[model samples]
Target: MNRQAQAVILLLLGGAVLRASVTDQYLNYVKPGLRGFLIAAAVLLLLTGAAALWQGMRTGSPAPDGHDHDHDHEHGHADDEDGHGHHSPRVAWLLLLPALGLLLVAPPALGSYAAGRTGTALTAPSDFAPLPAGDPVRIGLLDYASRAIFDQGRSLGDRRVQLTGFVMPGPDGTTILTRMIVSCCAADARPIKVALGGDLPPGIAGDPNEEQWFEVVGVYDARTVKDPVNAESIPYLRVVEAKAVATPAEQYES
Candidate 1:
């Protein structure tokens, strides 16, 4: 490809990595195991760039083809122009950096920031049909959070619940929040805030205002009512045990 195009590619790759390093919000779109793909792509980009630069550098005078072949070459000037247009190297491979970022860390959809900012707790129904009851019910934090705002989460009143989300620390540090999954865009992302209500677990409690995916498996410690909005005010799903785990995508379907 041309030097101009190659230059653009080099800049874009560096920009994408910089964004990924700072943005944990993009955890959804990414799948696990993406390091190998990125490394290979980066190496290929560098090699192609080097080759293009070499071609540009080697534009010295062409060798003479035996005396009077000049007339024959005059018409071929058009061919040179055509070759430059058609055979100019393409920097398309440079796009692989952003692609790798998408595969590696497909950002999580919008989260509580949007919800709290708008004074909304993600849209939920008056009730969710029956959550398949199990010995120790494995529920999602988003499910609990959505239900918390609707006053209909009695379905899980005293049952054991399993939730996976990130920690949102409380003031006391005695308890930490576990948030759940959200798909689609962050404009509607909602976090189920379950307070881990037992002895302090290992690791620093999560940053309250950030996104920290975890797995908090515990029994529902009864529900509590918060500042209700109109007739639809749900109760919180208090938990007894919360073990942090990486976020899962299947928890919240778009």
Candidate 2:
């Protein structure tokens, strides 16, 4: 790639980052707290690219060749007869593909396909605090999983809880309610799953589709099952009610 092309790539990459950071799109890949850093990095890249391009234009820099003609001339050597100077590897241009994808067609967050292939991430056992007072209190999948698996659902008690996540087909044609939890970004995301039992609620009308988002009301079930992929014990939720729902704006739990 030539210097100008390199600069353009920088601009494209910066624009893609800025576009994601300025909207909810960034949430699909990373935690909410990293927005400021992403914006800062994007601005830096844009400024650097702009400066390089401006300098090249103002100085009327030579061809895309990786050489400085004026310096070569001062050294008493004429420009290359072939008019082709050593250039960056052509493979570098491939970087533009991902940049373009981010700009024009950002990928969706990880869902059931990812959840089914990975083992659930369970935190080390710890004494969990009491769940807040509410019948069917809204709770995160990770929190519920940790409490149920490591803490044996002691903190859950008889209170009904609500969870929202995409559905994943589980062993023996069962359903798994899942959410991806990321420590940094999507690349490191791990599934937090709760096996769903009992009939679908009236609002759903049918078996939940794979990757379909749903809001489920249920009480923790003591029964556990092995995750087919990794044989890890997955906790269960006895569904009292469930309904199809749109994917949430922030799909991952940080």
Candidate 3:
């Protein structure tokens, strides 16, 4: 509540932002393109906090009468009322809690838990081009979904495709491959889901633990199912191979 406390809060918040921006942690909360802005904002906050703290310390010196004097009469009155110069309510300290948590341990990106609750976001119908030349061409989950659902899997053909996403359990004991799509940040993120069918690869048994990342190799299946949450048709993939994979640096698709 005091000038020093306010400045410390700013510094803590600034440090937390800087830490998230400099590392891969920022990807969990925002798009990759916003990293520069986040870094710039953090630097500005740090500078402002440093300047305010220095100014507060410089102006807090005692007068000859053993009473603190401030440059402004309003501040002096506030100091008189609180005795310790605290100018705001004590509840403001609560803002520091999130800052401290961010600095200590950044939260993980949205995964199966979010995917299960959110309905699949299907893009507007558009003509999709043919898959690139590869035995197992890599494809984004949203793109594949669009091709399967709207285009009726014409672009997909018989080529095997590879998709990388976290696992989400679907209705009727089905498995789902999911990725979050975001225009700006995680607050507006929506799930893009594809149901997985067929047998699992060797050494991988049973349904994967929720939220575990995986790279699945499969071909398009004509089967579509209704989403329990939104009743939207979710396309299917007949998986031929699958393996656990590390989470990517940027988890969300733009």
Candidate 4:
């Protein structure tokens, strides 16, 4: 690409990155901790592109063959006559496609469509303490799963709990409460989920494809359910109440 085109592409990509980072939209695809890095990268790109643009305007465009006409070609080696010696490779131009896509139509974050494709269970560590006093203790999906599956539900101990996640359909005609755990970005996101033991009301079970978010108040059921396909331990929750809720500002948990 020519200097002008390269500069424009850089500015656009930097703008897109800044927009995503400033508005908290970056959380949809990446961990919350990456905010600083994204912002730094955007600033650097903008500065570099602005500098290149200024230089391009001052120096004018290159020759059709990408050679500097003002240079002393007469004294140069015979092999330099082809003009291809200093030209950039054509493959570098392909980098513009991602920038254009980001500017025109950004892709949505991974959701139910992604969760259904992968069936690996997420396990938590075994260092949890007893549940504090609360009718319903708000806890993360991954933490609950870890205690339930790995620690054998000792920490839960009859305490009511609350979890928020989207609906994921199970192979046995059941619906699961599911959330994706993102370490750095969407590419590394993995699903953590639990099976709702009792019958779900008509409203909450209405549309599995919609990927509706919900806050479920329930207690852990000691009875462990096993994934027949993978033989992984699946956590279970006995639902006391279920309410439809707005999707959280940050879709994925760290």
Residue-level lDDT tens digits of model 3 in 43-118: 9989999999998898887767876756456476877897765589989999898798898878888888888888
TM-score of 4: 0.86
The parts of candidate 4 lying over 4 Å away from their true place are 61-86, 206-209
Write the residue-wise lDDT of candidate 4 on 1-254 in tens digits.
Answer: 56777888788888888888898678877888889999999999999999989887756645678876534343243337555543345787787776666667777777888877776467566388777677899988888988888887888988899999988776565578888898789988988878877657654563464478888999888766655557676788988898888888888877
Best by lDDT: 3
Task: Tell me the tens digit of each residue's lDDT in model 1 across 1-254.
Answer: 44545645654564454444344433443322443454556566556666665654444225475444433354356457775333343456656667466546665455444333322245667657677768667655566666544545466656667766555444334234534334443334444445555444565244443455556556555444332223223334455565556555443433
Relative to the unseen true structure, what is the C-alpha lDDT of residue 164 in candidate 4, on a scale of 0 to 100? 94
**TM-scores, one per candidate:** 0.47, 0.89, 0.91, 0.86
Candidates ranked by TM-score: 3, 2, 4, 1
| Sliding window of 10 residues with minimal summed lDDT for model 4 | 70-79
Task: Rate residue 54 of model 1 by lDDT.
Answer: 63
Runs off by more than 4 Å, candidate 1: 1-120, 171-176, 185-190, 198-214, 221-235, 246-254
Clashes of 3: 0
201: Cα error in model 3, Å? 3.4
Each candidate: RMSD:
9.0, 4.0, 2.5, 3.9
Better of 2 and 3 by lDDT: 3
| Best-matching candidate per TM-score | 3
